[model samples]
Target chain A: MEQKKVILIIDDDPDIRSALRVMLESAGFVVGEAANGEEGLKAVQRIQPDAVIIDLMMENVDSGSQVAIKLKEDKYPGPMYMLSSAGDAVRYNIDARELGLAGIFQKPVDPKVFISTLKAKLGVA
Target chain B: MADSSGKYSQSVLSKIIRFFLRDEEGSFPVFLHSLRLEDQLYDFTIVRFSVAFLIIAGSLFAKYILEISQLNHYALIILAIILFFANTINFLIAYPARKKKEKSSAYRFLLIFILHLSIATDFIFLTIALWLVGGVYSPFQTFFIFHVIIASVLFSPLISFAYTIYGYLLFLTLAIVSWKQWLPPIFPIGAVPSDAPPTGKYIITVAVVQGLLFFLTASLTTHLMYFLREGQRQIVRINKDLERLCDQRKGFLQIALHNLRAPISAIAMHLQNLLYGYGGELNDNQKSWVQRSLTRIDELISFLHDLENLSVMENADLLREANEFGLNDLIEKIIEENQDLILSKNHEIKIELPEGKIFILGIQRLIREAILNFLTNAIKYTPPNGKIIVRAYRYSSCVRVEVEDNGIGISKEDIPKLFREFVRLKNQKREGVDTTGSGLGLFIVRQVIESHGGKVFVKSEPGKGSIFGFELPIHIKK
Candidate 1:
């Protein structure tokens, strides 16, 4: 029996998280959820998911990139992606590759493309 | 510009000039570069005070420290005391006015009057001191150049020239008259080498040469003042224009960002639900809802397209894919894309093109958008079932495209304002017309056409119709 690939989702908007959860679940991946960057950090520690998808979630404790940097410093061995709502992720001026992000997925991500990108980066089916 | 310490001084100075100098409104900061009248007065006041104090210290230093005979320490000391007392009394009155926030108009009038009197008195005392020291041969006569320079910085060129002449006349009268055998002068001032009586020709020649030098000083300083004032005014004007442009850019971005973010997010949630089969396979009702959402998304995409087109033209960016392309082909493609809207509105759009392929050299991206803007504008402004005639033809070296509609036309007064950013005509609304224009379309068209060294044309009668379009040169200058 094969084990399910676990993906963590971090977003302040409940609707966005639930919508993403349904898509990922349908794609045969277990989805973990957190409301903000702090909970996301704790979730990363607890769940140890294979891949992490975080929202921009501005006007909260720390921005999306700050959480990514902290998780990397904490030695969270997982591929990370940012789901940005502000048109695109490049506007933040954050270097995705340097920040150890596999890629940036613009908000309202197409499920097929999102899953495929994750599969390619994680080297999974 | 009005600092806290100098606020009172400025208000008073401006008030005085407003009341007294009728021509001040026409030309301001007339002498000093950017200094207000009050700031210039303060500078003049400080310089006058320092000079008076320096004269007293300088005479005392020379009389006691160096101790040269025939120095006439008695006369110089008396002149220095008079200058010092006169300046001190004026300073006492002006100093309180400079500090006080609310001064009466009468007091302000007095302070302004005192400043003029102070400058006038400086000339008399300095001239006397110069005569006592050595008359025409006085080394301290060099200070007269500074006097002329200050006058030029404060007054107009003609007045400064007159003041320079006054200085020379004083020198000739005092030094030349007292030395005459026939003149009953109380005391006589002399040349540097007074052992032998100097020739009258030598004295007259020195006075003439000194007068020319004073005139030169006045002319040069006034010239410098004119250039400085002009340059400062230019910088201030440029700064105001830059601020206005920045404000316009800020407003544009706010509108663009708000329009992009909200609807896209709303559409995205529904799209993910329908496309990914969030719960299960959708029924017919759910399918119709999804279809409507998709249509909304299409509208959003077109709006985003317009935004991107306007922004690129705003930046005047040259597209990297720019190459020779057919103008007729671009227009035909745009019409085809908008065919559905035209048919639905029942607008009969007739396009007239040149016989063969008319090619133009430039970025196709902006030109395509510009023509699309024209076609769409004509379609929207005209009533349902109206005639929209689009013509593209050769005019010597240029290609002209016109979108003529016998629908609602612009008024004569409003025609000039048609191509400006965010301009909606007063009478643009009509039955069965899409009056919801972003108002940026024609502005973008004008920018694109003019940037190619081409021109836009509009001819209209309010009740009859309007012809709106642009001409682009085949060989565009890079």
Candidate 2:
């Protein structure tokens, strides 16, 4: 039996977390969900997922971005994905390519495209 | 009273005419000169024709009514011929000289003196003739009042007073001489004997009444004219003060906005670097958090920008510089620039613009900022795979641009305050979107549009789509 690839999803919206979880699970990967950046960080430490999907705006205001910075500074080896609203993407200078992010998706993400992009970034295709 | 050197000087007369026609250099002076000349020609023709008709009719009536022995018929005929010759010579000599030296002050004074002298001669002759016919009971004494009134209204008060004195003296001299039986026994009416002495008391009473009436009318008219001129001066002063205050307010606002720009720009740049991993390589979780912080910084900067614009709008004269541009091109550029965000959500943008160029006058940068704000808000509220349609068309006297989105529309309560600064819907708050925005986007948009003399309107229903539209005037320059 092969070990299933685990991915952590950090977002304040329940709909987004649930949708991401269903998409990753259906793509033959194990998924973990946290309602905030803090919870997401904890889940990352405990589950050590192969990749993480985070929202740019969430509780604690920029906690998700702070978590991403912390993980990178700590030399944590995992792919990161950022999800932002259209306004946020324009207002904030978030370049996924430059930030070592595998991809950045605007909400509400499509289940099929979300899964495909995640799989490709995680080398699970 | 008769100083030979004090007689009306030609130089003084020339100065007066020159004052009336000081400048012939500009278009206004030329127009005025032509108008004056036309008026003078019209007056001359009318006066000459009317006076000539009056003289001819008067002589014909005298010839038919009087008997050969009544009053001295031969002397009356001689006096009439002499008066007619004198008038003809004055008219012929004066008219040509007036035309040649119309703009000369000395000519104007001479013309006025000659007119007054002619009137004085007519009055003296008429008075002598009336005295010969009916002493103080002559009906022609009423005509003396006309001369008094004309002198008071047209001449300065000093000149009018002098004319009044001269008239009183003349009346007194005629009355005394006729009463003493020193003048000829001339009478036209059979009712009055030629030996009857003129009534001194009646003549003096008439002169006093005429002088009083002339002074009263002249003084009252001058007072009214002065009052109106002063009122106009006060109104002009008030308008100048208001303009000065408005200019000062604009100057202060410009200085304040210029000072705020540097600080806001610095903050935004620093935040941008942090979000982009200029500090260090961000792990999966760190990158997401930093990006969130950058959004909040951007929001704050946008709010500052709005405040600066609102200040600019206070001074109407310092409004944004407008230039003509193609509306379609501007919209296309904004859409293309934000393509990544639209693509990320799988949202489709549909642009429905007129086929030809929709030329509009606006500040390109401000218009772009306003449109970008609208598009961002549309995409922010819309759900995944939602559609945004931007339409542009020319309305009467204005151009209308609308952005419609089929997304989670604004609630009824939030719609009213959607354009207010720092006002975000409760739902956006519930989503834990803690972007550092000062929430001044819509407010800025409204201010910018209004500064251009345009208007912005929004329509939204919760759970339905939202439509935002703005109209700009077609001709904004003037």
Candidate 3:
């Protein structure tokens, strides 16, 4: 049996995390969730998921950037996808390509497109 | 009711004090006093005190001189003391009198006329003293022109002429009295001057000189006053126009900001859900489309942010908390952060920064926004293979930052309004570049610079490229 690909969803909004978990699970990937950057960092350390999706503006403001920066510095070998609101684009000074990002998913994420993007980035197709 | 009455009484007391303190040359006292019973009482008290002071001073000076006057010495002394006492009694009686009257133009005219009358009386007395002593040869007559000049300055020609006529009449009366020997020849101390002219010629010469002085002084003063008044009127009109323009600008900004909020919020909300996967799973093609949507949303968000900043700046409440930061560090951070966008556009960003440390005092967030806005515009406008140069140098008292682009430059006509909100350059409009700009980038840039007591200047011409530069006061700290 092929092992299930694990995906971590880090977002301060519970609704977002839950919705993303449903979409990723339905797409045939194992999913984990964390409500903040700190929790997300710990989850990444424990699970070392195949892919990580993080929200740019979280509880502490720029929490997702902090997580991404940490993951990059620590040489986390997985594709990182950033989920951000339109407002966060300028606020977090986010440049997806420069940050070694697989892609950026702006908020109100289209479930069909996001799951497919995750599947592609994670090589789950 | 009692509280209001108490306040009213206090107000009355204050008015009375002001009435006494103010210069009383015009019907200002009568006009002010007529409004309320209390003010009238105050005015009367002030007038009585003034009259008393004059009478006492006059009597003392008269007693010391002119010992052999025709009038009885005892009668003059008695009359002066009586007048002084009468003034004091009137002042005491008027303090509580409460018969308020409406302000009337008659009162204003009378007050002004009385002021002129008193001045005329003073001139008459001086002329009489001069005529009694030796007429035209009197040193006092030489200074009589000074009084005419002063009258011309303070009063209108009509008033001055009226006073002059009164002066002449008093002089004539005194001359007649001296001629008939009814008044003593209070001249020469003991021996009349041997060169003394006949009294008629002396009087005529004095009258002629005074009349000429009065007319000349009056005309010159009138012209001078008219010129000053006209200049003051022009200044007042200009200030009024500036105030109206400022008010209109404020109104425009208010409406613009209010109109922009709804669309920006809608875009943000929709973009939020799409980025968070709220709908359903997607394919690779769908993923690309969603990403494009996200980029569009980002552009709109940036535009709205610029609009908000411009509104804040217009209100003069753009609060900036200053911190010391290195210019090169910030520029590098921006470049490092925006490398992907630059690469995607197939453009190059060249940096020519000073090696030495250049520190500036600014809010870190605002400076970052301003620089990022400039860089974004540079990238957006520059064509593929275009170049952007971000340069910084230390000039006297300031640090200059220049962002030069070898892209389409603004036309000369549009340069003047380049830093105004919602003002796109004519060239940019003609080039038909689908720039997702708020047309507020340079506006915000100028505002931020001005708040720092600095300035932003742009040099651009059609097709020649443009250099947007700003200078900030250098901060030695850090």
Q: What DockQ does each prediction reach against the true complex?
A: 0.13, 0.02, 0.07
The TM-score between candidate 2 and the true structure equals 0.40
lDDT of candidate 3 over B358-423, digit per residue (tens): 888766556766787788777777777789999999899898888898877777777898888787
A1-125: candidate 3 lDDT, tens digit per residue? 77899999998777677666766776789999998999999999999999999988777767787889899999999999888653344334565656777777755555566776666666676
Q: In candidate 1, list every pair of residues with a backbone clash.
A: none
B459, model 3: CA deviation in Å? 1.7
Tell me which of candidates 2 and 3 scores higher on lDDT: 3
Error of 3 at A92 (Å): 8.6
Where is model 2 more than 4 Å wrong at Cα?
A1-125, B1-242, B272-299, B311-323, B337-347, B361-370, B380-386, B394-398, B411-456, B472-478
Which CAPRI level is candidate 2?
incorrect
TM-score of each model, paired residue for residue: 0.40, 0.40, 0.45
Top candidate when judged by DockQ against the true structure: 1
Cα lDDT of model 2 by residue, B257-285, tens digit: 54554444444444444444445667878
Ranking by DockQ: 1, 3, 2
Q: What TM-score against the true chain A does chain A of each candidate get?
A: 0.90, 0.89, 0.93
